[model samples]
Target: ATNPFTITKLDVNEKPRYSKEAFKTSTLQRDAYNYLGYSSTRTMMLAQYLYEGIDIKGETTGIITYMRTDVTRLSNEFVDAAMMHIQKNYGAQYLGKYQTTKDQNAQDAHEGIRPTNVLHTPEYVKANVDVSSIKDEKLFEDAMKLYARIYGRTLASLMAPAILEHTKVTFTSNHHDFNMKGVRLLFDGFLKVYEESKNKDVLLPKFHQGDTITMDAIVSIEKQTQPKPRYNEASMIKKLDELGIGRPSTYASIIKTLIERGYVTKEKNLQPTDQGILTSDELDKFFKDIINIDYTAEMESNLDKVSEGNYDKLSILKTFYEMFIPMIENAKVNMKKIQPVMLDETCPRCGSQLVIRKSKYGEFIACSGFPKCRYIKKEEAPTDS
Candidate 1:
């Protein structure tokens, strides 16, 4: 029997387990389609616009607070403003105080997502932008929804904790343990508008914790372990963040660099190709002293110190290049020769090796032999373009 299942952030490399019912089904293929095809990036970009700001209402107006944040802490001013708004607009009973406990290690420098101007309602701002501007309208709509979520959470934090009733059901067959859980919501609390995220319990007809359940059927299936999935943008960002290897602004650029250098491929998600693995391995091997983990960490620290005025900037760069020089020399002498990876499959005109060349159009393919071959490829636009 085939197993149907659902998982969240399950590392993208897990065997599907048999289950009678499931929700939020996801797979490597599904994520690849969503991200590799640019849908996920486009969606995030739209969300960022709403979170940041956009040219709407004849002025650049941002809806929610900054999107790129790990902080759960809200500003005191924002909290005060929200409480005032709730008291005036909603009611005293609807207001609840919440305190989101944050870990000391987390980077919570920025406040939680909030409205730039709580007074600006979605309908009020709608008249400011052109009716034909779908981009502005979409951005405005998303901003308004996120604003509501942040505002609602602020209110809910102060309210009494939501109460829940739960029951558990267990079924066993063929010496295998199977378990199921159900929950029932006792109060709506602050889950009025945020109902979609509310975990409504699956109310089971009265059953005790020790209740025995009869098995209707037993099913078994063969399964195979799958290899680790290639890194996708979001997961890669998370990984990079965890490693402390790069900053918020650098992760996207690093991934883009890997793609441009043929170190990685984006198809079926961002998989490090053979060349990528080889190149990374080679660099790490011969240039270990320059590019290894310790070097990177120390260099980052020095850069931080420089920014803080404790160290000179030029001296750091000089020290880096000075250390790198010997590594380059040693690699030139001892490293095995490797051919440069070419991106284009073939020359546009002569079917020769299409070596990449720098040009006004950024980068282009031309015959490797150049002048003697005298062949250049100009990009032509097709109807599909």
Candidate 2:
């Protein structure tokens, strides 16, 4: 096996590809979680400030379009201004065609989340946001950071496609074909403004059709199969988006409700509480069909149809009631009662086990031996430091 590697073929791609469109609520949340480690709820809150009009240069005006939208469309005015801005700053060759891709589920009620004015650079917007008016330095910083992302993405969307030289090389030895691919950046088009969080260019060494490669050690590596990862706020929202389960405006509230109901907790990632798992298991045993993810998605789709006047509201309601009323009746009689989720803490007053409970206000910690031991834990509110 002298010179055990031989190059058999080389193929390269000549086409250029553009970067993704501007931020919608789902994409924005995913990027925020990945880059800033901000939760979905927090990201929405920060985005809302930009949309609701910020105090800029002593004047109150909105700096970005509506935040709670799934649409990626840009207005004709915005597209023209952005193209002109690109032509002036980056040159005529860098200008891109104005087009947007949307899924069928998109409402298309508002344009993508973008800076209301292309000239309103993130730095300019931040400088003018009066600290005296906002009164919080951290809030100002977070809002500006998110605003920068939206601005950059919007600009990048209208920039020329990045030209890349993708080379695929095949090596042959002992009747075995091995493949390797490399890419070189021919032109950094949209990349000038917005850099994607994942993926980078890999430049490969020059290879001809007939070239010999020196042999390296061949190894069969053993790898352990990884388990499916649990979903965080961003990933959970992504899943929901794919399933068309909830609207953009409701995503933050939905996640917030999960936390408030004590079903989910925020740690390194969004983790479901043990109580949450128990409740899910109990519900699945009794109402698996009603609470299924697919069923939820179907219900959402039906609601959309009703809103669009394509489906009859009464007919849908009738079908739902026919399927649901019997389940409710059966659950009332046959569903087993679940035990309280006890905490590791013991009540100071009666030395009884403390447990999590839900009330009008929200979840709270109370004694498991409730009627006998009337103990409730009061949490101190966090103050701005």
Candidate 3:
């Protein structure tokens, strides 16, 4: 069910748009969040260290601009500096017109993520920064890698758009339609630096719109439809951002809490444990309003309003507590403890029944005789269908 499946029919648009702005925006956000698999909080923490003064070559200097920003707007001074750096480094052809589009919900308090000095290339930083003096070579290395990503992305954002030629070929045979697509890069433009945006080129034979093509071979393959994928760290953060459940500053802490508690495990993907499921079920049954997605999103919006001075903080708190306090008391009195589920298998190390136990790392099988026989094993994750 997790494997890829074959497609039978494909229809191509007459005039396909080659612009990648819409796709780039979402991709960049994910890339930034997932930088080095660091949680949003970790990324910001490391970024802050870079932004704050670091002892480098007997001088204290910031390596990057402010990192806690939801807006992508750059100041005129920085924009001009980036343009000059781009022109000097990559020639005038790579330069692009600077334009700022404001997002209504964006908190434009600081400039978007960018290098403090555009000319301070990642290679130069890696070569010059005295790792021995810093006492942390790995930290300095990671900082350089992250700086490169931000530098490339910020510079690419201001560079010329990549030009691509998309060609789609569709064929009709026996009342069935088969299609193939081809994409050729006409110009690299910004893709020269940000190679992650480049898509694999699919070349197809030349054919006119009305032309019919013969098939070389035909085969039927069996495949199953896969269920929706579980959220990883990057996707989870992206989802929270899209749902307006948390602000940029809180994303990392929120995920960290889930992991620190026994709610979710980040083994390969974020998967809820038996304890998490039970807790969610209880909350859904007793305190649906407070634990609901919509309610939480609305609360976030209200908090934003308070920050903007549009809503009173005390009034909002009072209104929330009026209903929340009763629910908390009711849950405290009525909530039941979830019983451990015993497995058919016995502990490998001890001759005792194995039972499912929940921990910070999720569900695992442990010997029933805990203190006497401290043997435990990780439970296998379920396959998606």
Candidate 4:
């Protein structure tokens, strides 16, 4: 706060928030419509297929470079390869230079999204893989097309930094600070391949610093702050990535696990279920130390220590078990009194009151007045028959 010498120059008139005036503002909604229709697992399967390889045009060809990467990196080899392909196929002008990013956190292990072999375009593949001629061929075609888009994005990323010539038109109407900032594309760069990603810029005729622009209309619109949106898969993964709580590979599994454990449910939005709330609350109350944030932090630290041979994993587990056993016993002794469960609903087939029962699989409702009623809600399959 005290270092003025190290301060960076700021654009005072810049709009901090995303503009609603743009044509393509609903990106999150669009992505949800695209990917979330099929379950996360199925989507991953198709993407993997596209990434691996596809048999098209009577020759085996790879659609995409690779999938399952969080890194926004492009190798020099890949860049060179792309440039070579572009020159050979399109033209010399299509070939672009490598892109530079200031983000030091970018993973450099994998190249940016590109076709494994650009010689095998989607059109070439479609010629052999007819839509109606074969089953699952259409699915392959769709995946291949998406792969082409990814490849285009990689190429565009390698192109020159898109320059935006910003112009601010200021009109002081009744001493109100009303200004409209506009931007025009200074250089199109890689947008030739992937123009959909870029937002259309508004072109202003021209303006000087002191020029008094005429007010077209005074439109005062009242705005209210929107409530935070429910976390989507992409945004959730991004947050997890930022917190360093989970790796890129584990992000999908974490979400999946949360669902499987009944910790959360994905309806129109992801929400914690009653079971999740109860479980978390009970655990927090009875096992405060174990459930606390510090405990998790310490556990991570200890795991790192164990990995480095500074601590023994078995010893840590043994110590934890020793402490936990007594707590379990204490909870069992001190916990609420047990009440016998009963089913209120009657058997659909028989007019008899249902009773609560247990089996190896779990618990269910069975007819208590069963001998005469001949009603049984089978909890589990009979082991023998």
The residue pairs in collision within model 1 are: 96-158, 96-159, 97-157, 97-158, 98-157, 98-158, 183-201
Q: Model 2, 150-235: lDDT tens per residue?
A: 98899999999998888999889888888888887878898888877756667776678889898666666789999988888888
Q: Rate the local accuracy (lDDT) of all candidates.
A: 0.54, 0.85, 0.71, 0.56
Q: How accurate is candidate 4 locally (lDDT)?
A: 0.56
Q: Write the per-residue lDDT of candidate 4 for residues 1-385, one digit (tens) a residue.
A: 1111211221223222211111010222223234434444444565667666655645455566555544555566766877776677656655555644322333344444456665555566666653443458656655655555565556655554445567655444444445566775655556656555334566665455555444444557999999999876656655555544543345567778877766778886668876677767777767786766566646766776787799999999998899788878877776543232666787787766787654434456777675777676655767875
Q: Which ten residues in a row have the lowest lDDT in candidate 2?
A: 197-206
lDDT score of residue 257 within candidate 4: 80
**Top-lDDT structure, candidate number:** 2
Ranked by TM-score, the better of candidates 2 and 4 is 2
Off by over 4 Å in 4: 1-39, 86-113, 128-134, 172-177, 195-218, 260-262, 286-343, 346-385
Q: What is the TM-score of each candidate against the true structure?
A: 0.63, 0.79, 0.74, 0.64
Q: Which candidate leads the pack in TM-score?
A: 2
Higher-scoring candidate on lDDT, 1 or 2: 2
The residue pairs that clash in candidate 3, if any, are none
